[model samples]
Target: MRCEAAPSATSPPAEPAAVFTQFVVKLYSRCNFGCPDCYVYEHRDRGWAAQPLVMSPAVMRRLSGRIAEHLRSHRPERAQVILHGGEPLLAGPPVLERFARRLRADCQGLTTRVDLLVQTNASRLDRAFLETFRRYGITVGVSLDGTAESHDRRRPDRAGRGTHAEVARALTLLRAPRYRPLYGGLLCVVDLEADPVETYEALLAHEPPAVDLLLPHATWHFPPPRPPDGGEAPYGRWLAALFDRWFDAPRRETALRLFDSLLDLYLGGTSTSEMWGPYGSDVVVIQPSGLIEYNDVLKTVSAEAARSALHIGAHNFDRAAADPGFAAERAGLAGLCAQCRSCPVVDICGGGLRAHRHSPDNGFDNPSCYCADLSFLIGHVRERLTHGVSMLRARFVQGRWSA
Candidate 1:
């Protein structure tokens, strides 16, 4: 199951290997529900419009073998493999079942702990599909942007119909005791208009294991909606309201990514330390064609830029990891922010998510689009910090410290 190509004799002695921690595999390049804000088609550099709808069997087989080999060699403590795509569910049950079966068999040696997850829209959930997911212990995170009005505004179908009803109904079914464990939680994009309190309550009713709020994909060119100059905070205000409500909650398990990041930063840790930071661990994305890319969101930055000449069948994980071009892309991220070099919190924030720094002129050599938002949130947290230790203790005890 393991293969380690000998390091070339001419090359200097190998440095310690960076452990491979997480990987995203694209099962298909097609989706059933075409959300307006989707990065794959709406904003991507590479076109998925003409690509194969599903991953070929050959690629899947090779992928399984390679991953198994990696597991055996690296003995990664916990390897997370997410089934991602334009719409991963587009590949029917039979296909996914075979893929998962092969993956299990391939990862034979080394007690390699694995975390399997699927991010889906929930519109395609069915008994058979549910069975496959449950069987593999796949944690399903459904994309539903809060209330119907809020969700329908941007997450509409190609025909412009609202998908909220289908998504809500699906959640209701998934939350039933028989399938509740499979209901991972809801993932919503921050829609400025929706009342954060209402959105929080509505999603909380389903009682998911967590909730994730994401800033809509945007850049200076196609900036996400913001309040006009001199107007009140747009995304900041909305998130602030949610933070208040969450802080006031009596009991909660619905984790919020933003709140968690802010909390970590406030507690003298890097925000997004678990996910987006530089020391935040490495993530590799595999497209259906077996092309390896970084921060899949970069797919939206340009069509041609997304096509890396890498394939799972032709390349081993070690070779791909040693790719000079790939290493350069990773290195280029740190230099993107002159501000980060001088900022004390760069280690924690990683200049915001890598994809967010992308721009036409400098590539991924810019700060986050949400820089202002982060500043606002950090200021709020710092103000609270300056108060007496007694006040901080009181707030924590009162549960009024949620991000």
Candidate 2:
């Protein structure tokens, strides 16, 4: 996963073996509710429509075998399997149990530690599913946008009704002391229109151990929305506001991945997530029909970009990683465009998300459309860290003098 450069695109060279630490497996291809913001269904990816509603028994066994082979060969320090979907709960508890059992049965002897999780919208979350997850040692993560009003505006049922109440009801169950052990945290997409402070406070109501704040998926071809004021670096300003609230807190209320990673990278430490930093990508995706693909976020560019011809039945994980696009994705600094590579804060933004760099003219060889936003956000964060560190040093000196 940590490679300095990619194999040549046209001629290519033999690639060293890669150890994939994270795998996103699609359990279901369709959702009971319609969330217009979904990257899979609402985006350019119409391929999901043709996939089986639930992964077939054959595909499950085959995919598990491939993963077992990977674990045995690579023996990575840790491995993660994220059960994903149009709505993974739609696959039902029975199917999920079997899937988990199959994975455990196949890789029982492997030395690698495995973390099993499910990311769902929580409309179908209940005790029945919770029991199965708890029994199998699977943690759960729910997608809940800010509060009821903002959440409903972006994510709603097919009938155009709000889902915050229903989702919150499920969260109440997941938050029980017994179930809190399985709480994986909340995933909230950034809402520019909503007051940043208000949105952060609203999400705090859930008492989640962690919070994943993501910029809505966008590319140069389709830039993300800006506020009514049309301010420069709007997303950066929004994130900075959120960062101040989280950073200035008396105690660490929750783990915010975006800010946490930024702070770490600024202080000369490695980031934990592939979404940030120039670290090589060690993540892969298994589509509903057994397609072994690259970044699913690339579906925002084009469905085909996220997909490949490799299948679990025909190709092993190694073969899948050998794909040119796969290598290009994990290319680190070499993956960046001339523009991004020249930027002063390129390391801070890491050229932004690869999907955000996509364009028809140059393919994946462009700076993120959020370039200005990233520069602004990262610069602001660096300033705050510098100021905070200086004050800490001064406080220590003052304490010593008093003593």
Candidate 3:
């Protein structure tokens, strides 16, 4: 939890501080599929257009060295290395294997645990790829929207053909007995227009241990679509409906991260996802070119929104941490807008995602574009929890009095 940099001999001794524990390495800058909602490829960020299609080995080596140095200096108990991309699988198995091996070697003995994972579209998963993943202990997390119709509508190949069949084949392979353990889960971006229960049920059919329902990245500059009438909080109502369905299920199903995080917060617990609660930025993004930046989700706000001057070739994690973007993100709740600070549910919503609050005029000093939706959802959750607890307490009192 320290926030001071390691001291150098030539300079005055400085305080020690926490370094990044999660590194998102973008192995490729181009995707095979053309998901219209993808933040990297289809959003306002055109930075990827300038990056190499694939990460060079020299850059990877430099990145590994930097990460190793950071791990040694900070000495965190555990670290996560996520292989991300426009489509990480596009880098192919050979590159992925070598990168994983090199990263593992570099971090040897520096940390207690190193967890490797890949966020892939699953279009290219095959036996060879699965074998490489299994050998390197890299768990695979697939990006799936829901039912075939819902998924294909948003995710299509360059030719504009549906990719659902290919992804489904990969899912079948992943769920096989031999490969099931390597299956991390499903990452689904929420489609408010889709039937919530139907989409939830479709995902359940996949038997994933967990599901992450992500809010499509948005800002006041590029707000998400709204109903014609603009009657109410569309996204919030959709989420609440899903939450009720999930909560009332006769048996426990897959872990719905968004709902679970909110429930945990309402029950006086903390959230693990940065999307909720006051969270210090412990994640860093390493581009294919070895440039360092804050979370890539910021790209949705603007092409240069998350860009940092530091690169893995020239700077260590400490230098990246000192960057203005990184510093602002790590500031947590202190970085929120004045309006967010005054809101009652600010503690739980964390002013929504930082990227969702961006504006050319106000910078990040504004409530999220989804501020109303977040308030509605959080209030709904609070009310439900309070009522449930009240009912339980009343039952207990009555039983005691009758006894």
Candidate 4:
């Protein structure tokens, strides 16, 4: 019933103090699969090549201390530590087990509860990995790009062959009754060429609990497949189509993070993700070398975009958070451009993701290259939500739920 009009232009929320709660730990910096569009290996930043192949025990100890230090200060009820990498499973289960164990031990007795999850390509997933993950109460999140055909197009092996078979095989295990609870979600990047409905249905086939439909990371320097200031807001049209399919489904097949976040915000509820709403940015990542830096995704923008002078061994995460570079991230609405701030949907779009606002001319102060698309998508959702609620109320005489 509480609906904020989706502004005609881009916008996000006002800046509240940023408290870091989510952390990513790169167990290994090397991967078995060769995804051509991979932000880490193929993006603007080539720093991954020089990074340690896997996190050493010494680095792990320091990372634990740094994360623990942050937890002691923020005292968030629960903290999420996602294990990632070129392909974290490349490091083997034993190494993962050791990393999880160390993190738990280091943060012991802290008010914050550390929950661990591993995000993987799922090409190398097997009983060995699942068993180890299970023992530590670690959850498993696989990156399967919808159907086999669609998935193969974006994610292939180094040898130029599709990895759909192996990924599909791994998903079976993760979807099994014994492991389904650990099935964090399916992650599908928006592919404009693919049929939106087909792509969504393919993901539904997995029976995942949730789905993360990410925009292919791009900046002004390098635009997405369908650029803005033109006739079609292709990405927006695609999502709007998918949103209708999801919103009208008689039964909820999966919880989509993007759509869910939008819906929650429309209903006067706070967001669970920085992807939307006016939520303060509070995510961080630790590379295998124990460097506490900004979100690793920023590497796609530039080499130095995500780097920081802060190292876990030398500084607590608090100091790292205070670093000028990282502070720019915590800027919230203030971080957005004048055009975005004046946009009607500012609260919903959040000036697009921070990374998407990049341009050499204006630095990180420009509207996202997806500005047209975000405007289209957010505006469409707001209209549908308002109309749907109005219709539902019209159908009910009392305008209230009754058993």
Q: Rank candidates by TM-score, best first.
A: 2, 3, 4, 1
* lDDT tens readout by residue for model 2, 1-403: 3355665688556556776778999999888677776788888879987888899989999999999899888798889999998799988999999999999888898999888999999999999999999888999999989989999988888898999999999999999988999999999998888888898998899999999888889988877887679589998899899999999999999999988888888878988765568866878999878988888898999868888888888998888777887888888888898987888877777888899888889888898888888888888988998899899999999999999
Q: Candidate 2, clashing residue pairs?
A: none
Candidate 2 residues lying further than 4 Å off, grouped into runs, are: 1-16
TM-score of each: 0.87, 0.94, 0.94, 0.92
What pairs collide in candidate 1?
A: 43-300, 44-300, 45-302, 45-303, 46-303, 270-348
After superposing candidate 1 on the true structure, give the runs of residues whose Cα lies further than 4 Å from its correct spot.
1-14, 229-233, 268-276, 328-333, 385-389, 392-403
Q: What's the lDDT for all of these models?
A: 0.73, 0.87, 0.87, 0.84
Model 1, CA-based lDDT:
0.73
In TM-score terms, candidate 2 sits at 0.94
The candidate, 2 or 4, that scores higher on TM-score is 2
Writing each residue's lDDT as its tens digit, candidate 1 over 1-403 gives 1235776879777665654557788898877776777878778564676667888888899888887787777887789778878778878888888888888777756588877788888788777888898888787889888888888886887788989888888888888787888877788888777888988887787778888888877775567777566254467667777887886578775788777777776676664333335453356778787777665666656676545677887887767666654554456335447876566656545566556667788776677787667656555655544664678788887886564
Residues forming the 10-long window of minimal summed lDDT in candidate 2: 1-10
Give me the runs in candidate 4 sitting further than 4 Å from their true place.
1-18, 227-230, 398-403
